[model samples]
Target: MQHRFLLGTRKGLFVVERTVHGWRSLPPHFPGLQIPAVLTDPRDGAWYAVVHHGHFGTKLHRSADSGRTWTEIASPAFPPKPADAPDIRCPMRGVTIPWSVELAWCLEAGGDDQTGRLWCGTVPGGLFKSDDHGDSWSLVTGLWNRPERAKWFGGGYDYPGIHSILVDPRDPTRLGVGVSCGGYWVSEDDGATWANRSDGMRAAYLPPDQADDPDTQDPHRISRCLAEPDVLWCQHHNGIFRSTDDGLSWKAVPPPEPSGFGFAVAAHPIDPETALFAPAEADVCRIPKAGRFVLTRTRDGGKGFETLTRGLPLDEAYDLVYRHGIDTDATGNRVAVGSTSGGVWVSEDGGDGWMPLPVRFPPVLTVRFV
Candidate 1:
């Protein structure tokens, strides 16, 4: 297993390390803060944490020394609402979407050539970009100004949020985005413009006739194969989907057994055909199937999947993995699983077996192997 992994939890940020003795936790950094998003930018070896302070609003912190030291940086924010701008109501809750940052849902760095470039997705359906290493951020108004945003409602949040951003490795300008209840979008011109490209992903949560509407699909999460950026895996609200042509069109794959409803999915670093999913019940029942903790892996795209349960719980386990709760190292052999139930586990040899890191964390939201 890798020597270290970062844990972003409901209560704070923790850097878990493996030592000669055992798993050693460097003192918790944001002790009482809620870390909603984290990013270990491979571009510059810097760590970024997006924290939420109930009354203080959302803030961004960067650690350049591998969690040893930290610095406060400017967080993503929306410009003041124009007095003449029309008020928009959330389609799901019928409440006006606030022109403020509710939560920083995701963080991703730009391509290797684009240093100091970062992307952030937030609740209320806004995308922000930073050009000076978090010194300042500007909302990507292209996506925010889209009319489809009015059709986008919440997934788990009251207002819709963008949780996944895929920066294509081949071309820094090419991008793929995943939103809860807002459908999939792609931009080939570096986010200056966008297009809804979720052609085949169906949303069983909607009326049968409108289930395939591209503008209202709810994709729980999406992962892109680093080795094959054209291939993308989507864990949708209805089922699992795959795209072989840069997310232009999606194909429904065999939903992994026990269930296909899950939020977390991990793609192999080197293999486009390989991926893993954390299975759960359905929308109302989000726990593991029959209280048995397991993960489904497919090495042959989505043609087939195998259940893995060697070192996971089998009875009375009720861990629910969030969209960003599971992650894979560069090699893809080392995998990490963090759950909302406060349990974290690692698998050194793919999904063969697991080793539980001895720590009681506050609901783990995101796990990143740095």
Candidate 2:
């Protein structure tokens, strides 16, 4: 079977197909909108894309017949400001938190049998749920009303966002979400309620006393081991983390080498012990360490990591991989990565080797294999 890739880019979305001969890039889809997230639901072959338009706002599109056509669906939005609701304030910074729905930062489909269920994470840090595909959405008020939200801050944007959503394949009601600067949260009874699972995680920017504060921990990205749903991995702002009991608690994993900061993390589909990360310089720099592009892989959970750079640029190359810009196939042997510089690479035999897909599209935001 030919491996297919759906690349969400800053300018649009592109589909790249890989066969025995090599990789081929197909035409772009949703030509001018910035696509921050895209997902092709294998259960029913439904495609969903999150489009961000600077002038108009964020919108969701659904494609029933692959990417050949699409239909605009109800975009997720914040509830109307309550007349008696008080202004949100940031407890740590002593400032009023600007509350508004900016964009859909992440899109995740529900379980294989739950066709109409969809979960979306948005800027200003709100989680929304849709039971009819993308037709309409309702704010997950349980999480939105959490008291800890007063402490969540933005890591890169003006406000924090739920950029990673993981729906446990074994239970349709179980869900996990990773927020930038807000940390991690897990729900056992669907979106009815959430619990902060940032314990043991650290935030370097904070003082020593507040380093382990759950609300202050910034998780750049989080992924779960497909073969072992209880095992979770996170590329944290300060370092890497892993959780064996779902997201109840996280343990810091020694970051591999040059720098520990990064925004993307991926787990092998069939191996709970294997994971991938693209380390970059500190947040201030946001560039590859030493100007070299390399991917660090860990075969024994986070015990140790090996830097893979066989076919990657060695010098003067600074490519940043976003939180959703890396993914692996079902076999766990095929991995694909897209960078902010529009660079795309694939590793066929795990992370031991690599090959570049002959296409430089827009600044890549997310990449997925179907």
Candidate 3:
């Protein structure tokens, strides 16, 4: 079977196809527009892409024939400011803030049985839902109107955004989302109501006593095991974390060697005990730890992690993998990783080994197998 990979980059979106011989590249779809997120619906083979224009704002596009063509769709927008809407204040710092929706940070396909249903997470931290595929979208007001949102702050950007959305495969009504600088949230009733589930996560940048505060926790990225939705893996701002109760609570997981701080994490499609992470230095410097590139895999959950570096750069290499830049296929054996420096690599045997794709493109924002 042929494998298809979608590479979202700052300049556009590229399609990488792999055959028995090797990998082949297709022309970029949205040339010059920043493509932060893209997903292919397995239910009907529809493709979705998030296109962000600096001055024109962000938009969503869909393609039925893979990446050959696309149609722009209605994008998520914040509701008109209410007359009584008060300026939001940082919960911990007590600073008045002006928050507005600026971009769609992530896109996710719903459960296998929920055809045409889609989920979107956006900057300024809003969750949206679409029952008619990408044609129309509505803000999940239950999450937006939460009182806890008033305290959320941005981890990298000026405003916190939900960059990870996980729809429980076992139950379509259950959902989870991760926000930068904010915390993790779960909804058991199809997003009608939300609650913070970041119990054990920490925010090292905050006061020592405030480190464990849910609102102060920064979850860079979160991934769930397809085989066991209750198991989740997170690459947090301070370190790695794992949760066995569907994100109700989390525990710190030490990375293999250099550091545990990184942006991306991917769970094995079939094994709840396996996962992959791309490690980088802490917030002070986002390069590969100690100037060496490696991918760490844990087959026994967080009990132990092994570093996989063969076929990867060994010295003087500085590549930062974004939160959505690493992904594994349904088989759980094929893994693809993209770097912010326009480098791409693929591993057919899980994280055991890797091979670089022949050509380089723009700064990659995300990578996924369709």
Error at 191, model 2, angstroms? 0.8
For model 1 the TM-score comes to: 0.97
Worst 10 residues of 1 by lDDT: 18-27
lDDT by residue (tens digit), candidate 1, 1-370: 4678899999989898777886666768899898989999988899999989988988999999988788999988899988987888986668998888899999999989998999999998899999899999999999999987888888978888999999999998999789998999999999999999899999877789988889899999999999988999999998899999988899999878889999999998889989989999888899998999889999999999999899887689899999999899888998999999988898888878887777778899899888
Which is superior by lDDT, 1 or 3?
1
The C-alpha TM-scores of every prediction are: 0.97, 0.97, 0.96
Residue 17 C-alpha lDDT in model 2: 87
Which residue pairs does candidate 1 place in steric collision? none
Between 2 and 3, whose lDDT is larger?
A: 3
lDDT (Cα, tens digit) per residue for candidate 3, span 123-160: 87889999899788888989988888887887767777
Q: Supply candidate 2's per-residue lDDT for 281.
A: 82
Give the lowest summed-lDDT range of ten residues in model 2. 90-99
lDDT of 2 at 133: 90
Q: Give me the runs in candidate 1 sitting further than 4 Å from their true place.
A: none
The lDDT values for all models are: 0.90, 0.87, 0.88
